[model samples]
Target: MPTRPLSNEVLQKTIDVYIASMRSWTDSAKKLGIARSTLEHRLKVAKRRGMLGPMPKALDGFEVKEYSEQIGKNGEVKSRSTKYSPEGGGQFEVPDGYKIKGESVLTDADGQIRARWVKTKEGEEDPLQVASVVRGAFEGFVAKSPNIWRLKDHDEDSLTVYPLADFHLGMFAWSKETEGPDWDLKIAERVLTETFQELVERAPKSRKAVILGLGDLMHADSHKNQTPGSGNIMDVDTRYQKVLPKLCDIIIQCTEFVRHKHAEVEAEFKAGNHDPASTVAIRTGLDLYYRNDKHMTVNTSPSPFWWHGFGVNMLCGTHGDGAKIKDLPGIMASYKREMWGSSKSCHAFTGHVHHELCTEKDGTRVYSLRAPIPSDAWHSAEGYLSGRSMYGFHFHKDKGSTGRSEVEIL
Candidate 1:
């Protein structure tokens, strides 16, 4: 028969046998069926750690269920191991700056409960602190001096609207991968700026102009490079820190450009599924940039629905990610009852499908504008394709939609 290896239990028995034999090493080794050297080493370890009789209990708030010690041949303790569990009915407090990742509780056959918790460092930024940082940065920024431009001849009763939808500024798409035109931050900026300049030059000289950002102005809301609500991974052009400031710059440049063309300019950015928080940042940045300018009005509302009344024409807009398109007419009617009741014509605009759709029901005309951005990898792979274009709508105070200008991307 093979002899069993030495353990803490064997060591305790050996200690007792040695004492019973008047501390004789040879007698203890013979009785335990171990080598005399092994008995001597284990005894030295037991004496060194004072663990000769029984294992020590765990400290407060913890219970050591199992204990082990490895001793070397040279009468030295090599290592000690312990398995600890939270005490029964004990509260486990997660350390500061940490969050519980997972937890489990096991009830032993003796009806004693053992609890285990795994914690991870919390990494998400607080929204309030992020907003505070953005607000502070914008507040401290010294805006450039406004360019002095004389007002040109413009039609007082007309309002021109530049609808920018699904610009997807931070998106990245390769021509080979998506089977579409290559797009990135640089291309998007150039295409949108040039398109807006062309549209502005061709459209009628209206006294009031509106820069309407229908939604998805930014591709990803944060550095996670994922859809804000769905958490779907996205192909992004750059980091969020870079994209946000650039987004603000683009809007400011466009607004400044249009300010020179019209007598009064108003801008509103609607929240979208892709960029609910980013829309707030853009609107806040715009408001801060033009707060001193008398000719500019930037709507800083975080509302999902927005409306503007130009004489008898009621212009209503939403991101269109929520609420069925057909239901929008009724929604607008209920939300803007006064405007809907008084207006001669009502027009509602939305952006989400990345394609143009027009429907008129119950006296309200709802148009889903086409996005200027090219199809990304996911859309291309899914066989979703649409012509990329933006529109400029001109409306008269008494008439709804006098004319439209389209800039189609090739």
Candidate 2:
């Protein structure tokens, strides 16, 4: 006699009933009229298909109430009990396009284990797969125009570059200890917007504008609220949920502002010591937002150094944490010889120190722009007090940098 081929539907239905019964695998197998070996084999298949997660721990005599969280429109959690089985088992509806990974314990402030529930979120997909899907989805939407605006030959055409460095959008600081201006998501957004708006107003009208993110746009890289490399605890304003969208919105607003003033806008982002992964997330979100916009392009390359060229000017930028300032000119030339060979003037804008400083080496001027953000506790306690300001530079087509504008925060 040969064994019958397993039906996934039948196996899934049996597993559910077995789970609801809150019986051990052996007892469930006997009740389902199947051998323990057969039952285990089917369960493994279900696991591979993502139809099942890790088995719940035995509760023994303790009361087990299984419930699912009903999130409101505002994302507030509302608990709703689906089953009150003493042996502990519940079936929760997994939303479409998402799957439950596994259960994790929810702990309280007193270091006591509170509860355990399945963690459900978007199903894991390969990055390349996601990119391909996104490309296919927007293939028809993207216009054929590579350059929307006509390039005219002019002797005085200028491009303005604004370096928005170390915004640390979700960082928190108090007025009590540091005694400086309080810093939080709200203040960060307002100051950044106002300062950029002021810079745009002062800068001469240009054909193109580059909104350069000098990294550390996020204060914390992980849910632990710590820096990426050192794991030092950081002051955070709120959960990643609220912070991400706010940062994206701020970037969108700034891009739109520059778009209105210039024919083209290019936004370049660099990874910071504080936010290696989050910076990529920010770029992905922004790319999706501006997918169909012909006038704007978002560059989210993982490379630490990037350069943009216009006529005789080459403007290279980095986060300034990876390589020293003295080696940047050589690095830029090595990485982008075509760009370096074509341009007569080379400049590097770096932003890790969060203060305005300028130095020249080997005919390449390296400028570090000031961040308008206030000092956090660690920085203030170390007496690293530096004047906060924003900067924008005007580069001429043939004459290199024509002028620069500064907006110091009072």
Candidate 3:
């Protein structure tokens, strides 16, 4: 007798029973009142229809309106296409390995707004994905042999902060075009390392040191050589793969240098408009590299803002691209209420405009540090020139704003 076709509901129920029965063909077949062959055939049909394995589920704040999968000859999923519709007002989610290709909206006669987002398989690896892969590989390599350095003795009451703002690693700038010092990967590494070493040597011997990256650590966020937020084209020095490793190397070098000078070193890299994802990758690498070192603390938080409390002083830092400088004090107070209330002196360090600006509001002083890197082609063409420099601020436990050491690039 020919076998009758089973409905989707029946097939799904069989599959569920089969799974619940621990994938025993005899048990599932008996429970479903079907022959073993019939059960197997139904499973084959379900697999062919892309219903055997985990199906695409609805994303948060959105519902999966449509889902299709391309099956290869070997029964492997070649690609996936999904259409998502927002359940309500808010941002929609994109399925993994998919990118938003197009969007459409329909307005019914009843005046209901229905929007659909078509997402296709992403052809290129996302920057954050690439970072994750690289970070894993790096973690594996560094885990075998951990390097722990000796700590130094220094003043316990003082905390020194090395503010590295807008280093712009991987940026390309010609001296003639930008009317500034020529910069590239090699030059940037040399200038940053050399300048930081000089600053470290000149800085007072504090027990704790903060290597604060005030943002724009990389000229480009990803392989696309464009700003992450604005999508503006950037003048890049080389491929992103090469630049990312070099970024980790520079940070490692700076941290090592600081470790020798201070007993405890805390490193934090903020996400700038250009290198938000890159900063995460860099910090991940740093954390993995220094995971075994008890004296080194790497802040790998994905938050845009970072803060540290030392003695009676509180130091906060941000990329300075989101909130206004004047508003930072209120933000700090609100975000870090305990730290704000306990500390006698509060200071927020920021970098984005690439110039020095010191302003006090509501008892918190916000300082926008200057970048050591010269202006790139875009900034130069726009006549946005500023003095190039880096600074290290020192804070006394009881007294605040003791002094600072500066490195001016001439």
Candidate 4:
């Protein structure tokens, strides 16, 4: 007989498991043996029929609360319970059609948030649109909008901790000859600065923000093993000067920008396989592969592959060498099982894989960043291709405590 059709309950449960397992629409489709677009269509159908729910249930443990302002009750807000996103973020819409950016609010007696209302240039509100707007607001889940203001000011203890990974700077790219000669470093600096500036724009306005430098800051020399002869192999000192400086400069500017913004903001860095192999080279008789002065936190061998402490929980700077994309979630689960001795979700920023991707592994979010490389080499495909595309992460400060983070393309 043909395979039995799935029951509604079974289908729903299967959908949840499928989503949790894949952590992304494209990967889910691929593993389920369906086309990515086709899988997307099926998911839409499921959502429309109301046979679906947020995988693992979005915002599961967080309670919703309300906060109202005394000024015309002007700044009104709703927020997700603090237990949920750590950031205590919430969403909202103006019923009176008032102009608004982001709001800073506190939880009310009821389990709802009273948003701090802000006046707009000229605007009107429709209650019908308010519910959806509010839902998206609290979660950093924004769609299209005509206007938005950056919101800030919250207690550090009241913020959420997140990982900003997927920065790829240390790789070289042969130009289609874009800028004049020796433009890669310049291009890298520009993009990195732009990204840092954007991050500064988003920092939370509450407490001192804690950061995890995740990994893959540079393309490192590992890729040299991937594509031989496509590039040159220089002495460690020469290559270090070529690529390391650009990355170090970006970090210096980043921390400097942070210091400019907040005196107490703390930033931490980690090493990944994408970093120079010499970073991990063992001194087996006097041969050293690479060495970094004091630029990165985990610059020496026995690289700090993982960082765990304080409220930050865990940090993984591994370059994701020899790991399959589809299997990341399981691998992370195992990492907790073996390495950390705890099951808290692991947040890792891995590089070497250029594609932009995200997945829920065990409990953590594993993001494969789109690097900020200035070469045409990574642009090639099975067919024909030219030009380049790159991206990076910007962790915007919220208040004095936690901050909001975003992804920007360069």
Candidate 5:
């Protein structure tokens, strides 16, 4: 009898192929020509790596303003500013480096005091120290949110990539349900829009963007004719109408933000297993947009990610769906041989798995993004242990890679 390769070879091949199509063992085994038990063994490793996540950081405090004070010679009409004095309140006189040429400055917030004197003896403690104290009732006033998207005051020019993978718009969850109806297009729009705003806020300094989508756009269950379970989402026409407008709206908002920093902003849409219909639909939608007043060329499907006049040497992509998740590497390698069949390099992004991955094959960097769903917790139903910390990435010549900020809805 012919012998199969070593255990390691099969294991590696198994890990490479799995994707949205075969998230579970039964599906994976059937596709890979392996026994369900063998597939299960290989997948134990996939599940392990899929669970990688970043350590959580404590929330940052929001600075709030409350009380107002005036500081100066009385007739001069000096405004005393009250601020938070983290150190403590003391009779420290203000010193020479006066930002404002005022007689004195007083900023007092409830728990801290900040006062600086413009004119002072050269040998005195710096007056900037005095401005920290704040005097006011730290009560009743609603403070800002503590959740921040990105580092405060980080000015670095970096190209980041965000993969919006496998948002099967016209699809609904079979088992997962959330705040409202599962797969309700209306609720999904709100959630996705809010997430985009938060992601942009998280990395405001990001200059260039690689926005790609992992397929399964329509939830047309290519693997199986999914029975209409509790959340069986398949109202194609209505769902498309609801989702299409919202997607364009979200894309427009993200594009507006992208154009502000990165001159070369492009979005790519890779088809997924579920939404083969989306290929035709999204293109039509973009065509309508272009024919309208905007007059901007908003590229659409068949090409997943937008190159945005970046470079033709490398083709940008989205949702790399061909086989099950356990067999992605094998599937991708097959694509390299059977499809691309070239010695050139490319960059691609895919979503379907609802997890984050960064791997280099041949020369292309295939970024499998981490999806942010309200029900990311429900992946337990898939018999896998994946975390929801994956965001997007940015490529830079100097820094190598940056910008994979977590998506948030706050």
Candidate 6:
């Protein structure tokens, strides 16, 4: 038989178990694949290297049960008598250095019972620390849902949805360097609010409005000026401290404006590559800001995709950074199965390509929105000078899409 090379972890475990068992060297060596003399040498070397520690106090009357059973395809069980081995051993004396920290019972493909366990080194990994790390991930989310206000002369006519993807709010650019209009935090504020106003003005009166903050609403993830997920250095207008409060004010302004025109407003947010964590923070802020006001519903969830419904229309969107266009229709359908099934018309929107694109797959229509923000140095150098634009779709109560309004940046 080919000798399976033992790792340091396994060797240490084996030596510890041998000492704890108080078994003969010959018996332990035969059970393991090594010769009796080799086992003795390894034990001496392990002690010298400080890999073999003092044996743990033996558990009194701790008996281990062992049995084997093979089941046929026809559900006939056959019991077989076999020699007992350790939990992780094939034919060797199983190492007992590590106790069962935790275990989960599972069934494998062959319909056999399997036990999965988390094993740590002796006196390592505090249970309290493990629990604290797991607990830290959850943020207390309570739906302080307020009553939605309807338009005074509200006719269930149409709904307007703005696709505000890839805002990249704190991005910086110089006209002389990029040969395009200069961009910064100030310009971002203007373009987003102004374009949103123009888009709303051009659209028909609606009972409700959706002001979508697609993703990447910030250029830098942290105060140190790095991309959110990639950690790449980015061009920035100012410190995150200066931009954070101002950007939150800008969104509040947009939503407040929308609320005036429509009776109800649903402010939806999607996290982008440039501002994943920031997006969630911004959304949570918005949720708190309008918690008392009943005219708006704030959705600042950190999920990649979101869906909103209007009568017969099902509107879905993603950041467009992770998924391709062709896969979106199926993905949306799969994720929003009940919504997809019930709605007659499905319209999907995405951002991050910076250019506008439209395609139809199956019965779904996918629209890749054009960002209204001006190009930074990298986009300009790469010749990605797609015209800056924003789009708002008007959804009829029963007829699906009636029309769309677009505002362009010169």
Q: Compared with the true structure, what per-residue lDDT tens digits does model 2 show for residues 316-399?
A: 998988889899999988999999999989999988898778999889999887777888999999998878888888899898
Model 2 spans > 4 angstroms off? 1-156
Off by over 4 Å in 3: 1-153
Which sections of candidate 1 miss by over 4 Å?
Answer: 1-151
Worst 10 residues of 3 by lDDT: 142-151
Per-prediction count of colliding residue pairs? 0, 0, 0, 58, 72, 0
Model 5, span 251-336: residue lDDT tens: 56554544444444545556665666654565466556545533134456464333422222233454655543344434444545
Ranking by lDDT: 3, 1, 2, 6, 5, 4
Q: After superposition, how far is residue 278 of candidate 2 from its true place, in Å?
A: 0.9
lDDT of 3 at 153: 58
lDDT of each: 0.82, 0.77, 0.83, 0.45, 0.49, 0.74
Clashing residue pairs in candidate 1 (N, C-alpha, C atoms within 3 angstroms): none
Q: What is the lDDT of residue 327 in candidate 3?
A: 96
lDDT of 6: 0.74
Per-prediction TM-score: 0.63, 0.62, 0.63, 0.42, 0.45, 0.62
Each candidate's root-mean-square deviation in Å? 22.1, 26.6, 27.1, 35.7, 38.2, 26.2
- Which lDDT tens digits does candidate 4 get at residues 285-305? 111211231221322335454
Most accurate candidate by lDDT? 3
lDDT string, candidate 3, 126-189, tens digits: 8998999888888746331223334455888888999878888898999999988899999989
Model 6: per-residue lDDT, tens digit, 1-410? 21243345655766865866585787678767778777776665444333543322212221123334677788777544333223232323224444445444454453333343444345456789778877786557543222223347754678989777877878899999899999888878877877776666666668878988878777777797888677788789999988878788878877766787788888888888888778878899999999988878997666788788778999888888888888988987898888888899988898898898899999899888888888888889989988888788889879998879888888
